[model samples]
Target: MDSDWRMWSRRDLLAEGMGRRGIQHAVEDGWLVRARRDRYLASTAPAELIRAVRVGGRLTCLALLRLLDVFVLTGGGLHVHMPPNASRMRSPSDRATPLAGRGSREVVLHWVPLLRSLGADDPRVHLVDALAHAVCCQPARHAVATLDNALHRGLVGEPEIAEVFAALPSKYRIVRALLDRRAESGTESLMRLMVRAAGATYDLQVVIDGVGRVDLLVDGWLVIECDSEEFHSSWHQQLKDRRRDLALAQRGYVTWRVTAAQIMYQPEEVAAGLRGLLAARRGGR
Candidate 1:
Protein backbone atom coordinates (compact mmCIF):
# COMPACT_ATOMS: atom_id res chain seq x y z
CA MET A 1 0.00 0.00 0.00
CA ASP A 2 3.06 2.29 0.36
CA SER A 3 3.75 4.72 -2.50
CA ASP A 4 7.38 3.62 -2.39
CA TRP A 5 6.21 0.14 -3.26
CA ARG A 6 6.33 1.19 -6.90
CA MET A 7 9.16 -1.30 -7.32
CA TRP A 8 10.16 -4.27 -5.22
CA SER A 9 12.38 -7.26 -5.73
CA ARG A 10 10.70 -10.61 -5.17
CA ARG A 11 13.18 -11.55 -2.45
CA ASP A 12 12.54 -8.30 -0.57
CA LEU A 13 8.77 -8.78 -0.75
CA LEU A 14 9.04 -12.36 0.47
CA ALA A 15 11.19 -11.16 3.38
CA GLU A 16 8.40 -8.67 4.18
CA GLY A 17 5.91 -11.55 4.41
CA MET A 18 4.14 -10.80 1.08
CA GLY A 19 4.88 -14.46 0.13
CA ARG A 20 4.46 -15.93 -3.38
CA ARG A 21 0.65 -16.13 -3.23
CA GLY A 22 0.22 -12.56 -1.97
CA ILE A 23 2.51 -11.31 -4.71
CA GLN A 24 0.52 -13.27 -7.25
CA HIS A 25 -2.68 -11.71 -5.94
CA ALA A 26 -1.19 -8.22 -6.22
CA VAL A 27 -0.21 -8.94 -9.84
CA GLU A 28 -3.68 -10.40 -10.56
CA ASP A 29 -5.39 -7.42 -8.93
CA GLY A 30 -3.49 -5.03 -11.23
CA TRP A 31 -1.71 -3.44 -8.32
CA LEU A 32 1.73 -4.72 -9.30
CA VAL A 33 3.32 -6.01 -12.50
CA ARG A 34 6.49 -7.87 -13.31
CA ALA A 35 9.20 -5.61 -14.69
CA ARG A 36 11.82 -8.24 -15.27
CA ARG A 37 13.10 -11.46 -13.68
CA ASP A 38 12.72 -10.89 -9.94
CA ARG A 39 11.69 -7.26 -10.17
CA TYR A 40 8.12 -5.97 -9.90
CA LEU A 41 6.69 -2.47 -10.06
CA ALA A 42 3.39 -0.77 -9.37
CA SER A 43 1.14 -0.51 -12.41
CA THR A 44 1.60 3.28 -12.41
CA ALA A 45 5.39 3.33 -12.16
CA PRO A 46 7.39 4.96 -14.93
CA ALA A 47 8.46 2.44 -17.56
CA GLU A 48 11.49 4.46 -18.60
CA LEU A 49 13.96 2.73 -16.25
CA ILE A 50 12.66 -0.85 -16.40
CA ARG A 51 14.79 -2.04 -19.32
CA ALA A 52 18.09 -0.62 -18.04
CA VAL A 53 17.73 -2.37 -14.67
CA ARG A 54 16.47 -5.53 -16.34
CA VAL A 55 19.77 -5.71 -18.17
CA GLY A 56 21.68 -5.48 -14.86
CA GLY A 57 22.85 -1.92 -15.55
CA ARG A 58 22.04 1.69 -14.74
CA LEU A 59 20.87 4.26 -17.27
CA THR A 60 23.77 6.38 -18.57
CA CYS A 61 25.08 8.26 -21.60
CA LEU A 62 22.45 9.44 -24.10
CA ALA A 63 19.54 7.74 -22.33
CA LEU A 64 20.34 9.44 -19.04
CA LEU A 65 20.97 12.76 -20.83
CA ARG A 66 17.56 12.57 -22.49
CA LEU A 67 15.85 11.65 -19.22
CA LEU A 68 17.37 14.76 -17.65
CA ASP A 69 15.66 16.82 -20.39
CA VAL A 70 18.98 17.95 -21.85
CA PHE A 71 19.28 18.58 -25.59
CA VAL A 72 20.91 15.80 -27.59
CA LEU A 73 21.65 15.64 -31.33
CA THR A 74 20.33 12.16 -32.08
CA GLY A 75 20.05 9.24 -29.70
CA GLY A 76 17.28 6.69 -29.44
CA GLY A 77 18.96 3.81 -27.65
CA LEU A 78 18.58 2.05 -24.32
CA HIS A 79 22.04 2.96 -23.06
CA VAL A 80 22.94 0.93 -20.00
CA HIS A 81 26.05 1.32 -17.90
CA MET A 82 27.22 -2.01 -16.51
CA PRO A 83 30.22 -3.12 -14.55
CA PRO A 84 33.19 -4.15 -16.61
CA ASN A 85 33.18 -7.79 -17.63
CA ALA A 86 29.61 -8.16 -16.42
CA SER A 87 27.75 -10.86 -18.25
CA ARG A 88 25.11 -9.78 -20.74
CA MET A 89 22.95 -12.70 -19.64
CA ARG A 90 22.24 -11.65 -16.07
CA SER A 91 18.75 -13.11 -16.37
CA PRO A 92 18.65 -14.22 -19.96
CA SER A 93 15.31 -15.93 -19.59
CA ASP A 94 13.44 -12.69 -18.87
CA ARG A 95 14.15 -10.10 -21.57
CA ALA A 96 12.03 -6.98 -21.49
CA THR A 97 11.66 -5.18 -24.81
CA PRO A 98 13.64 -1.95 -24.63
CA LEU A 99 11.31 1.07 -24.56
CA ALA A 100 12.62 3.21 -27.42
CA GLY A 101 11.48 1.38 -30.61
CA ARG A 102 11.15 -1.96 -32.38
CA GLY A 103 14.07 -2.58 -34.76
CA SER A 104 16.18 0.55 -34.06
CA ARG A 105 16.08 -0.08 -30.30
CA GLU A 106 18.97 -1.98 -28.79
CA VAL A 107 20.53 -2.16 -25.33
CA VAL A 108 23.85 -0.34 -25.56
CA LEU A 109 26.10 -1.62 -22.79
CA HIS A 110 28.80 0.68 -21.40
CA TRP A 111 31.24 -1.30 -19.28
CA VAL A 112 32.61 0.87 -16.47
CA PRO A 113 34.47 -0.72 -13.59
CA LEU A 114 33.90 2.36 -11.45
CA LEU A 115 30.23 1.47 -11.04
CA ARG A 116 31.21 -1.13 -8.44
CA SER A 117 32.09 1.70 -6.07
CA LEU A 118 28.49 2.89 -5.88
CA GLY A 119 26.15 1.20 -3.41
CA ALA A 120 24.15 -1.79 -4.62
CA ASP A 121 20.87 -0.28 -3.37
CA ASP A 122 20.62 2.15 -6.32
CA PRO A 123 21.11 1.61 -10.04
CA ARG A 124 20.81 5.25 -11.12
CA VAL A 125 24.12 6.77 -12.01
CA HIS A 126 25.02 10.12 -10.42
CA LEU A 127 24.72 13.12 -12.76
CA VAL A 128 28.43 13.89 -12.69
CA ASP A 129 29.45 10.33 -13.38
CA ALA A 130 26.88 10.02 -16.13
CA LEU A 131 28.15 13.20 -17.79
CA ALA A 132 31.72 11.98 -17.58
CA HIS A 133 30.76 8.65 -19.09
CA ALA A 134 28.81 10.46 -21.80
CA VAL A 135 31.79 12.64 -22.69
CA CYS A 136 33.96 9.60 -23.10
CA CYS A 137 31.40 7.73 -25.17
CA GLN A 138 29.84 10.40 -27.42
CA PRO A 139 31.25 12.28 -30.38
CA ALA A 140 33.18 15.41 -29.37
CA ARG A 141 30.52 17.95 -30.40
CA HIS A 142 27.61 15.95 -28.99
CA ALA A 143 29.39 15.61 -25.68
CA VAL A 144 30.09 19.35 -25.49
CA ALA A 145 26.49 20.09 -26.37
CA THR A 146 25.36 17.95 -23.47
CA LEU A 147 27.72 19.77 -21.14
CA ASP A 148 26.53 23.14 -22.43
CA ASN A 149 22.90 22.29 -21.79
CA ALA A 150 23.72 20.91 -18.38
CA LEU A 151 25.41 24.18 -17.52
CA HIS A 152 22.59 26.22 -19.03
CA ARG A 153 20.00 24.47 -16.89
CA GLY A 154 22.16 24.78 -13.77
CA LEU A 155 22.06 20.97 -13.63
CA VAL A 156 25.83 21.24 -13.39
CA GLY A 157 28.32 23.94 -12.42
CA GLU A 158 31.99 24.75 -12.90
CA PRO A 159 33.02 22.61 -9.94
CA GLU A 160 31.08 19.66 -11.29
CA ILE A 161 32.69 20.13 -14.72
CA ALA A 162 36.09 20.32 -13.07
CA GLU A 163 35.43 17.07 -11.25
CA VAL A 164 34.34 15.39 -14.48
CA PHE A 165 37.49 16.56 -16.26
CA ALA A 166 39.66 15.45 -13.37
CA ALA A 167 38.15 11.98 -13.45
CA LEU A 168 38.63 11.56 -17.18
CA PRO A 169 41.82 10.27 -18.76
CA SER A 170 44.03 12.75 -20.60
CA LYS A 171 42.90 11.77 -24.09
CA TYR A 172 39.22 12.08 -23.28
CA ARG A 173 39.65 15.63 -22.00
CA ILE A 174 39.56 16.92 -25.58
CA VAL A 175 35.79 16.64 -25.39
CA ARG A 176 35.80 18.98 -22.42
CA ALA A 177 37.81 21.52 -24.40
CA LEU A 178 34.80 21.99 -26.69
CA LEU A 179 32.45 22.81 -23.80
CA ASP A 180 30.89 26.27 -24.01
CA ARG A 181 27.92 27.47 -22.03
CA ARG A 182 27.15 30.10 -24.69
CA ALA A 183 25.86 27.50 -27.10
CA GLU A 184 22.05 27.45 -26.95
CA SER A 185 21.57 24.18 -28.83
CA GLY A 186 23.33 21.12 -30.18
CA THR A 187 23.19 22.65 -33.64
CA GLU A 188 25.26 25.67 -32.63
CA SER A 189 27.72 23.54 -30.71
CA LEU A 190 28.24 21.24 -33.68
CA MET A 191 28.69 24.18 -36.03
CA ARG A 192 31.39 25.74 -33.86
CA LEU A 193 33.22 22.46 -33.49
CA MET A 194 33.13 21.83 -37.23
CA VAL A 195 34.42 25.34 -37.96
CA ARG A 196 37.24 25.05 -35.43
CA ALA A 197 38.19 21.60 -36.69
CA ALA A 198 38.43 22.96 -40.20
CA GLY A 199 41.05 25.51 -39.04
CA ALA A 200 38.78 28.51 -39.50
CA THR A 201 38.60 31.32 -36.96
CA TYR A 202 35.21 32.22 -35.49
CA ASP A 203 33.64 34.23 -32.69
CA LEU A 204 30.50 32.81 -31.04
CA GLN A 205 27.41 34.81 -30.07
CA VAL A 206 28.88 37.87 -31.71
CA VAL A 207 26.82 41.04 -31.99
CA ILE A 208 27.25 42.91 -35.28
CA ASP A 209 25.99 46.31 -36.53
CA GLY A 210 22.92 44.86 -38.26
CA VAL A 211 22.26 41.41 -36.78
CA GLY A 212 21.70 41.74 -33.04
CA ARG A 213 23.58 38.59 -32.09
CA VAL A 214 24.41 35.89 -34.56
CA ASP A 215 25.41 32.39 -33.52
CA LEU A 216 28.89 32.75 -34.99
CA LEU A 217 30.98 35.28 -36.89
CA VAL A 218 33.57 33.54 -39.03
CA ASP A 219 36.73 35.30 -40.33
CA GLY A 220 35.34 38.77 -39.49
CA TRP A 221 32.86 38.74 -42.43
CA LEU A 222 30.83 35.50 -42.72
CA VAL A 223 27.88 35.26 -40.35
CA ILE A 224 26.82 31.72 -39.40
CA GLU A 225 23.31 31.31 -38.07
CA CYS A 226 22.45 27.96 -36.52
CA ASP A 227 18.76 27.13 -36.28
CA SER A 228 17.02 24.42 -34.31
CA GLU A 229 13.68 23.18 -35.66
CA GLU A 230 11.61 24.38 -32.76
CA PHE A 231 12.72 28.00 -33.08
CA HIS A 232 12.47 28.34 -36.86
CA SER A 233 9.07 26.64 -37.31
CA SER A 234 6.79 29.67 -37.38
CA TRP A 235 6.23 32.05 -40.30
CA HIS A 236 6.83 35.08 -38.06
CA GLN A 237 10.23 33.68 -37.13
CA GLN A 238 11.07 32.98 -40.79
CA LEU A 239 10.24 36.59 -41.70
CA LYS A 240 12.46 37.87 -38.90
CA ASP A 241 15.29 35.59 -40.08
CA ARG A 242 15.02 36.87 -43.63
CA ARG A 243 15.06 40.44 -42.39
CA ARG A 244 18.10 39.73 -40.25
CA ASP A 245 19.87 38.20 -43.27
CA LEU A 246 19.01 41.22 -45.40
CA ALA A 247 20.21 43.62 -42.70
CA LEU A 248 23.48 41.75 -42.27
CA ALA A 249 24.05 41.55 -46.03
CA GLN A 250 23.70 45.36 -46.30
CA ARG A 251 26.50 45.64 -43.73
CA GLY A 252 28.73 43.41 -45.93
CA TYR A 253 28.24 40.37 -43.65
CA VAL A 254 27.24 37.29 -45.62
CA THR A 255 24.76 35.18 -43.61
CA TRP A 256 25.15 31.44 -43.92
CA ARG A 257 22.48 29.46 -42.10
CA VAL A 258 22.76 25.87 -40.93
CA THR A 259 19.82 23.90 -39.61
CA ALA A 260 19.90 21.30 -36.86
CA ALA A 261 19.50 18.55 -39.45
CA GLN A 262 22.42 19.82 -41.53
CA ILE A 263 24.67 20.09 -38.49
CA MET A 264 23.79 16.65 -37.13
CA TYR A 265 23.06 14.57 -40.24
CA GLN A 266 24.97 16.23 -43.09
CA PRO A 267 28.40 17.21 -41.73
CA GLU A 268 30.12 16.73 -45.09
CA GLU A 269 27.67 19.01 -46.85
CA VAL A 270 28.01 21.69 -44.16
CA ALA A 271 31.78 21.54 -44.40
CA ALA A 272 31.66 21.75 -48.19
CA GLY A 273 29.46 24.83 -48.03
CA LEU A 274 31.77 26.49 -45.53
CA ARG A 275 34.78 25.64 -47.69
CA GLY A 276 33.24 27.30 -50.72
CA LEU A 277 32.24 30.40 -48.79
CA LEU A 278 35.68 30.76 -47.23
CA ALA A 279 37.40 30.29 -50.59
CA ALA A 280 35.18 32.94 -52.15
CA ARG A 281 35.96 35.40 -49.37
CA ARG A 282 39.67 34.72 -49.66
CA GLY A 283 39.58 35.19 -53.43
CA GLY A 284 37.62 38.49 -53.03
CA ARG A 285 34.85 36.96 -55.12
Candidate 2:
Protein backbone atom coordinates (compact mmCIF):
# COMPACT_ATOMS: atom_id res chain seq x y z
CA MET A 1 0.00 0.00 0.00
CA ASP A 2 1.18 3.52 -0.79
CA SER A 3 2.23 5.65 2.22
CA ASP A 4 -0.66 8.06 1.54
CA TRP A 5 -3.07 5.14 1.58
CA ARG A 6 -2.51 4.86 5.35
CA MET A 7 -4.55 8.05 5.69
CA TRP A 8 -6.95 7.00 2.91
CA SER A 9 -9.81 4.56 2.78
CA ARG A 10 -10.23 1.11 1.17
CA ARG A 11 -11.91 2.68 -1.88
CA ASP A 12 -8.94 5.06 -2.23
CA LEU A 13 -6.62 2.09 -1.97
CA LEU A 14 -8.66 0.30 -4.62
CA ALA A 15 -8.53 3.35 -6.85
CA GLU A 16 -4.78 3.50 -6.42
CA GLY A 17 -3.95 -0.16 -7.00
CA MET A 18 -6.37 -2.74 -5.56
CA GLY A 19 -9.36 -3.38 -7.80
CA ARG A 20 -13.04 -2.83 -6.83
CA ARG A 21 -13.25 -6.57 -6.23
CA GLY A 22 -10.43 -6.30 -3.65
CA ILE A 23 -12.27 -3.46 -1.90
CA GLN A 24 -15.49 -5.51 -1.81
CA HIS A 25 -13.57 -8.49 -0.45
CA ALA A 26 -11.97 -6.34 2.24
CA VAL A 27 -15.42 -5.02 3.27
CA GLU A 28 -16.88 -8.51 3.33
CA ASP A 29 -13.94 -9.72 5.42
CA GLY A 30 -14.84 -7.10 8.09
CA TRP A 31 -11.68 -5.07 7.46
CA LEU A 32 -13.56 -1.82 6.72
CA VAL A 33 -16.99 -0.32 7.11
CA ARG A 34 -18.34 1.78 4.23
CA ALA A 35 -19.02 5.20 5.71
CA ARG A 36 -19.74 7.07 2.47
CA ARG A 37 -19.27 6.85 -1.26
CA ASP A 38 -15.55 6.11 -1.79
CA ARG A 39 -14.92 6.30 1.95
CA TYR A 40 -14.30 3.61 4.55
CA LEU A 41 -12.91 3.31 8.11
CA ALA A 42 -11.51 0.44 10.08
CA SER A 43 -13.96 -1.04 12.59
CA THR A 44 -11.42 -0.44 15.39
CA ALA A 45 -11.27 3.31 14.72
CA PRO A 46 -12.29 5.52 17.63
CA ALA A 47 -15.70 7.10 17.43
CA GLU A 48 -14.30 10.62 17.31
CA LEU A 49 -11.81 9.71 14.58
CA ILE A 50 -14.57 8.02 12.63
CA ARG A 51 -16.83 11.02 13.00
CA ALA A 52 -14.04 13.37 11.96
CA VAL A 53 -13.32 11.24 8.96
CA ARG A 54 -17.02 11.17 8.03
CA VAL A 55 -17.57 14.93 8.44
CA GLY A 56 -14.37 16.03 6.72
CA GLY A 57 -12.62 19.22 7.99
CA ARG A 58 -15.55 21.63 7.91
CA LEU A 59 -15.48 22.84 11.50
CA THR A 60 -16.72 26.44 11.53
CA CYS A 61 -15.37 29.42 13.45
CA LEU A 62 -17.95 29.24 16.22
CA ALA A 63 -17.05 25.66 17.04
CA LEU A 64 -13.38 26.53 16.91
CA LEU A 65 -13.96 29.62 19.04
CA ARG A 66 -15.76 27.60 21.66
CA LEU A 67 -12.88 25.19 21.69
CA LEU A 68 -10.52 28.14 22.11
CA ASP A 69 -12.62 29.50 25.04
CA VAL A 70 -13.06 32.92 23.53
CA PHE A 71 -16.23 34.80 24.47
CA VAL A 72 -18.79 34.72 21.69
CA LEU A 73 -22.41 35.77 21.55
CA THR A 74 -24.99 33.34 20.29
CA GLY A 75 -27.02 33.32 17.03
CA GLY A 76 -24.26 33.78 14.48
CA GLY A 77 -23.40 30.96 12.17
CA LEU A 78 -19.90 29.50 11.96
CA HIS A 79 -17.32 31.43 9.97
CA VAL A 80 -14.12 30.05 8.51
CA HIS A 81 -11.53 32.27 6.94
CA MET A 82 -8.82 31.08 4.58
CA PRO A 83 -5.70 32.71 3.27
CA PRO A 84 -5.87 34.61 0.02
CA ASN A 85 -4.82 32.62 -3.08
CA ALA A 86 -5.05 29.39 -1.08
CA SER A 87 -7.17 26.54 -2.34
CA ARG A 88 -10.72 26.85 -1.06
CA MET A 89 -11.43 23.18 -1.20
CA ARG A 90 -14.18 21.81 1.00
CA SER A 91 -13.41 18.46 2.59
CA PRO A 92 -15.57 15.59 1.45
CA SER A 93 -16.60 14.84 5.04
CA ASP A 94 -17.66 18.36 5.96
CA ARG A 95 -21.21 18.02 7.30
CA ALA A 96 -21.99 21.63 8.20
CA THR A 97 -25.23 21.73 6.22
CA PRO A 98 -26.97 25.01 5.47
CA LEU A 99 -30.24 25.98 7.07
CA ALA A 100 -33.35 26.85 5.06
CA GLY A 101 -34.57 30.43 5.73
CA ARG A 102 -33.35 33.89 6.58
CA GLY A 103 -30.98 32.79 9.36
CA SER A 104 -30.36 29.43 7.84
CA ARG A 105 -27.34 30.57 5.89
CA GLU A 106 -24.30 28.36 5.89
CA VAL A 107 -21.14 29.25 7.78
CA VAL A 108 -19.32 32.29 6.43
CA LEU A 109 -16.11 32.14 4.43
CA HIS A 110 -13.37 34.77 4.66
CA TRP A 111 -10.06 35.06 2.85
CA VAL A 112 -7.18 36.78 4.59
CA PRO A 113 -3.71 36.68 3.11
CA LEU A 114 -2.08 36.91 6.54
CA LEU A 115 -3.49 33.53 7.43
CA ARG A 116 -0.91 31.90 5.17
CA SER A 117 1.85 32.34 7.73
CA LEU A 118 -0.10 30.97 10.69
CA GLY A 119 0.49 27.54 12.17
CA ALA A 120 -2.63 25.64 13.19
CA ASP A 121 -1.02 24.19 16.31
CA ASP A 122 -0.39 27.58 17.90
CA PRO A 123 -3.46 28.97 19.76
CA ARG A 124 -2.12 32.52 19.88
CA VAL A 125 -1.79 32.49 16.12
CA HIS A 126 -5.33 31.15 15.88
CA LEU A 127 -6.66 34.00 18.03
CA VAL A 128 -4.83 36.54 15.91
CA ASP A 129 -6.34 34.90 12.87
CA ALA A 130 -9.80 35.19 14.37
CA LEU A 131 -9.30 38.82 15.42
CA ALA A 132 -8.19 39.70 11.93
CA HIS A 133 -11.70 38.91 10.71
CA ALA A 134 -13.67 40.50 13.53
CA VAL A 135 -15.50 43.52 12.10
CA CYS A 136 -17.20 44.85 15.22
CA CYS A 137 -16.81 43.97 18.86
CA GLN A 138 -18.72 45.43 21.77
CA PRO A 139 -17.46 46.73 25.14
CA ALA A 140 -13.82 47.27 24.09
CA ARG A 141 -12.97 44.83 26.90
CA HIS A 142 -12.94 41.91 24.49
CA ALA A 143 -10.29 43.54 22.37
CA VAL A 144 -8.29 44.29 25.46
CA ALA A 145 -8.41 40.64 26.42
CA THR A 146 -7.29 39.58 22.99
CA LEU A 147 -4.47 42.09 23.07
CA ASP A 148 -3.42 41.03 26.53
CA ASN A 149 -3.46 37.40 25.49
CA ALA A 150 -1.36 38.14 22.47
CA LEU A 151 1.14 40.04 24.54
CA HIS A 152 1.23 37.58 27.40
CA ARG A 153 1.66 34.66 25.05
CA GLY A 154 4.48 36.47 23.25
CA LEU A 155 2.63 36.26 19.96
CA VAL A 156 2.84 40.03 19.59
CA GLY A 157 4.76 42.81 21.27
CA GLU A 158 3.80 46.28 22.46
CA PRO A 159 5.33 47.87 19.39
CA GLU A 160 3.34 45.59 17.13
CA ILE A 161 0.08 46.51 18.85
CA ALA A 162 0.94 50.15 18.58
CA GLU A 163 1.67 49.77 14.91
CA VAL A 164 -1.66 48.10 14.32
CA PHE A 165 -3.39 50.86 16.28
CA ALA A 166 -1.71 53.55 14.19
CA ALA A 167 -2.80 51.89 10.98
CA LEU A 168 -6.49 51.74 11.97
CA PRO A 169 -8.90 54.12 10.30
CA SER A 170 -9.99 57.34 12.02
CA LYS A 171 -13.62 56.24 12.06
CA TYR A 172 -12.87 53.35 14.45
CA ARG A 173 -13.19 55.40 17.60
CA ILE A 174 -13.89 52.39 19.76
CA VAL A 175 -10.78 50.64 18.54
CA ARG A 176 -8.78 53.78 19.11
CA ALA A 177 -10.12 54.10 22.61
CA LEU A 178 -9.18 50.53 23.34
CA LEU A 179 -5.71 51.02 21.95
CA ASP A 180 -5.22 54.18 23.97
CA ARG A 181 -6.24 52.48 27.20
CA ARG A 182 -4.44 49.20 26.75
CA ALA A 183 -3.63 48.73 30.42
CA GLU A 184 -2.06 45.61 31.87
CA SER A 185 -5.39 44.61 33.32
CA GLY A 186 -8.35 44.19 30.96
CA THR A 187 -10.85 44.61 33.82
CA GLU A 188 -9.41 47.95 34.89
CA SER A 189 -9.44 49.35 31.36
CA LEU A 190 -13.01 48.12 30.83
CA MET A 191 -14.22 49.72 34.05
CA ARG A 192 -12.57 52.99 33.08
CA LEU A 193 -14.37 52.94 29.73
CA MET A 194 -17.69 52.06 31.35
CA VAL A 195 -17.44 54.98 33.76
CA ARG A 196 -16.46 57.36 30.99
CA ALA A 197 -19.26 56.11 28.77
CA ALA A 198 -21.75 56.68 31.59
CA GLY A 199 -20.79 60.36 31.64
CA ALA A 200 -19.31 60.16 35.08
CA THR A 201 -16.87 63.04 34.89
CA TYR A 202 -14.09 62.11 37.27
CA ASP A 203 -10.43 62.46 38.06
CA LEU A 204 -8.50 59.26 37.76
CA GLN A 205 -6.24 58.22 40.68
CA VAL A 206 -7.35 61.25 42.63
CA VAL A 207 -6.22 62.08 46.18
CA ILE A 208 -8.90 62.72 48.77
CA ASP A 209 -9.04 64.39 52.19
CA GLY A 210 -8.62 61.18 54.15
CA VAL A 211 -8.14 58.48 51.57
CA GLY A 212 -4.91 58.25 49.60
CA ARG A 213 -5.07 57.80 45.83
CA VAL A 214 -8.42 56.47 44.69
CA ASP A 215 -9.42 55.08 41.33
CA LEU A 216 -11.84 57.87 40.37
CA LEU A 217 -13.43 60.96 41.87
CA VAL A 218 -16.67 62.05 40.22
CA ASP A 219 -17.29 65.77 40.77
CA GLY A 220 -15.70 65.36 44.24
CA TRP A 221 -18.95 63.68 45.32
CA LEU A 222 -18.56 60.03 44.30
CA VAL A 223 -15.42 57.92 44.57
CA ILE A 224 -15.49 55.01 42.13
CA GLU A 225 -13.20 52.06 42.83
CA CYS A 226 -12.67 49.32 40.25
CA ASP A 227 -11.52 46.08 41.89
CA SER A 228 -9.75 43.67 39.58
CA GLU A 229 -9.10 40.08 40.53
CA GLU A 230 -5.43 40.28 39.75
CA PHE A 231 -4.68 43.22 42.05
CA HIS A 232 -7.14 42.50 44.84
CA SER A 233 -6.83 38.76 44.88
CA SER A 234 -5.50 38.38 48.42
CA TRP A 235 -7.30 39.04 51.67
CA HIS A 236 -4.85 41.81 52.51
CA GLN A 237 -5.70 43.75 49.38
CA GLN A 238 -9.43 43.23 49.99
CA LEU A 239 -9.07 44.67 53.48
CA LYS A 240 -7.13 47.61 52.12
CA ASP A 241 -9.86 48.33 49.59
CA ARG A 242 -12.52 48.24 52.29
CA ARG A 243 -10.48 50.57 54.48
CA ARG A 244 -9.99 52.98 51.61
CA ASP A 245 -13.72 52.97 50.85
CA LEU A 246 -14.59 53.62 54.47
CA ALA A 247 -12.08 56.45 54.74
CA LEU A 248 -13.45 58.03 51.58
CA ALA A 249 -17.01 57.68 52.89
CA GLN A 250 -16.01 59.38 56.13
CA ARG A 251 -14.51 62.21 54.07
CA GLY A 252 -17.99 63.06 52.69
CA TYR A 253 -17.62 61.16 49.40
CA VAL A 254 -20.04 58.40 48.40
CA THR A 255 -17.73 55.50 47.48
CA TRP A 256 -18.93 53.05 44.87
CA ARG A 257 -16.89 49.89 44.53
CA VAL A 258 -17.35 47.70 41.46
CA THR A 259 -15.82 44.32 40.72
CA ALA A 260 -14.27 43.25 37.46
CA ALA A 261 -17.22 41.02 36.71
CA GLN A 262 -19.64 43.92 37.20
CA ILE A 263 -17.72 46.10 34.78
CA MET A 264 -17.22 43.37 32.18
CA TYR A 265 -20.61 41.63 32.33
CA GLN A 266 -23.07 44.05 34.00
CA PRO A 267 -22.07 47.50 32.86
CA GLU A 268 -25.65 48.72 32.38
CA GLU A 269 -26.71 47.80 35.89
CA VAL A 270 -23.67 49.45 37.40
CA ALA A 271 -24.16 52.56 35.30
CA ALA A 272 -27.78 52.81 36.41
CA GLY A 273 -26.75 52.58 40.05
CA LEU A 274 -24.12 55.27 39.57
CA ARG A 275 -26.64 57.48 37.79
CA GLY A 276 -29.07 57.12 40.68
CA LEU A 277 -26.37 58.13 43.16
CA LEU A 278 -25.34 61.10 41.06
CA ALA A 279 -29.00 62.20 40.66
CA ALA A 280 -29.61 61.88 44.40
CA ARG A 281 -26.59 64.07 45.12
CA ARG A 282 -27.79 66.62 42.61
CA GLY A 283 -31.25 66.67 44.16
CA GLY A 284 -29.84 67.07 47.67
CA ARG A 285 -27.61 69.93 46.59
Clashes of each: 0, 3
The sequence of per-residue lDDT tens digits that candidate 1 reaches over residues 138-197 is 777788888998987788899999988887889877877778888777678888888887
Candidate 1 differs from the real structure by a C-alpha RMSD in angstroms, to one decimal, of 4.6
lDDT, candidate 2, equals: 0.53
Clashing pairs in 2: 55-93, 55-94, 56-93
lDDT of 2 by residue, 157-220 (tens): 6666654454445554466445433343455455566666767676666767667877677876
Candidate 1 has its poorest 10 consecutive residues by lDDT at 96-105
> What would the TM-score be for candidate 2 when compared with the true structure?
0.53
Provide the TM-score for each candidate, comma-separated. 0.80, 0.53
